[model samples]
Target chain A: MKILSKLRASIAVAAVLILSAVMFVDINDAQAEYGDVVINNYSDGAGMRPVVFPHWFHRVRFRCKVCHADLGFKFQAGGNEINMVKIIDGQFCGACHNGDIAWSVENCNLCHSGKPGTPTQVHESTVQKLAQPSGAKK
Target chain B: MPVSTFRAEFLDTVSGLARGAASPGLALFLWLLCVGAAWAGEWLPLANDGIHDPRSRAVKILQQPREALQGLTPDHAGNQVRWVQVLEKGEIRPREKLFPQTVVQKLDLDVILDAKGGMPAVRFPHRPHTEWLDCVNCHDGLFAKSVGQSKISMFKILQGEQCGVCHGAVAFPLTECARCHSIPRPGQSKPVIPAGIDPRIHQAIGQGQK
Candidate 1:
């Protein structure tokens, strides 16, 4: 009777763990789209949430030259060293996010709306849907 | 002091020392070299430094283009550089983040532009370009997502507009016609141009007028 009770308790614990895992996955998958980039290089360590950059959102208003050419952002994800310091200094996201062009950086939640522990990377959905390039950097 | 004025005054002072041990002209040359290096250090920062300062240590060496672009795949024509092949072969991998991490998300879509007047269709492959670029690089400004949106013409291109923005300048020169005008149109359906295609391609080829 005692052994059976122990086995039942373990099974109950395992079920809860599995259910929570599924719920956790569902939370991360909540609102991401094709070109959403999750940046968590410093967020987890800094005790803050990761940043999810929406590429299509910015593409609507500005030309590529505004950011990629004029602003000098590289093609690679997490390629540019974007920090709170740099953003505050009227460079990168700061150029537009500085009150006049768009919302000011004072609104932290506007950009840092990402999962807690997501790693820094170009979102997989954007690449996986498309075929990998012939001689892409590994 | 102004460079020209300083040069004139220095030369006047050193004219007496021209026949002396230090070869005054050579000393002036060395001084000018120092000045140039100082300016470069201030303006052109190290690659590891500022984000905009793109100068690399390897690129700073005297023998450049020849030395910097060593050991890469060669192309048969059009600037003689098969960049896709070199990147595929992994001659160099750019860092997405510092300490050598790289991520290249490529899309595999091809947009074909139908040419009129017995011309072959132009196939714009997204793979090679998207391999090194983000979608924002071209969309909404350079070329709209919708077909027939941008007015692309050979005349505009020759004048450094449309595709000419990169092709003639950074990418292969526009002289290589076969590279872009690759796809042959299928027979006899009146060769309808796609909705999003730049109409100038058909107009220019059909009328033989750019």
Candidate 2:
């Protein structure tokens, strides 16, 4: 009778532990699976201070075939060898910047000039000047 | 008083005490019954078959993209899958390479080609058909490579191109758009963009008729 009582008590404890473990795994799996791939890279690749690639800004105008096919850019970065000198030449950024699609070297300030947070300043000044009346009468 | 009457009364009292002791046994039995009930409550125990375990079942069911998409429906037991462009090779005018009832599936290249283009997810159903065929039926010589440059186009589709090489004639009719792009419920959204106005809306509009 004592042995039977012990067996029953052990089974009850085992059942409770099993249920709790299963629920814990279910929650953990959900969080891990849905976690962001891009977010992981931010921490892992933080040392590089990676180049800012604003996706929504550029993608609105260009087709995938233009940069991917014509310019020969691989899907993932570091997949292709990119050199700044090559971009200055008629290779990557220079493809359209030969004074056709967008501004040329004359407008170098558009990209390489502004420091972080300074781009907004330039836009703000332009808006301020536009709102002001010209000193010289029309 | 007689000694026999005293003994009879004593025996009746002992029987009453025995009944009282059995109540604890009954309570323990009830507690065990509750535990057994709790064990059965989890669906995993009921779902596990002898051949394939529940985890294995989730894996097996998830492997087929169609099964994952269609979900575990009663209609899934039937031989026919609702949506898919079925292609069979060499059954039509361009009877050059491949065989009849060859499956030609179209994978979405939007995400692969451009990061910003977003994932134009494909709706592939290989289970119901794979039951009848093999891998070579679709892949053939042009097995795996970067998409889009493989030369499959609208023209090719009309002339039985990549997938058209089969679906246009043998497996199922090409006129059936709903076969692949099934009529979604109202407000069904594309996978690539959010519920709000798509940023690519401007690009897609710009490319119109140009």
> What DockQ do you compute for every candidate structure?
0.02, 0.01
For residues A1-138, could you state the per-residue lDDT of candidate 2 as single tens digits? 997896677567656655655564322111111000111122123232222222212332443334544465543324444444665687866776667765664543233311122111111111122233566221
Off by over 4 Å in 2: A1-51, A106-109, A112-138, B1-210
Tens-place lDDT per residue, model 2, B1-210, is 122353345455555554565444444444444445444322221112111122322323222222222221111111122222111321112112122343433333222222222333334455534433334444444334445545444345544445553343223334332333332333644333336744532222121111
For candidate 1, write residues B1-210 as lDDT tens digits: 223454456555554454452433344444444444333222121122211112322223212232333244443222234555655566545422211233335689888877655556778888777755556677876899877677677677765567865565345555545567666567733344457756533332232111
Estimate candidate 2's alpha-carbon lDDT, on a 0 to 1 scale.
Answer: 0.34
Give the Å shift of residue A44 in candidate 2.
17
RMSD to the true structure for each prediction, in A, is: 29.5, 28.5
Question: CA lDDT of B27 in candidate 1?
Answer: 44
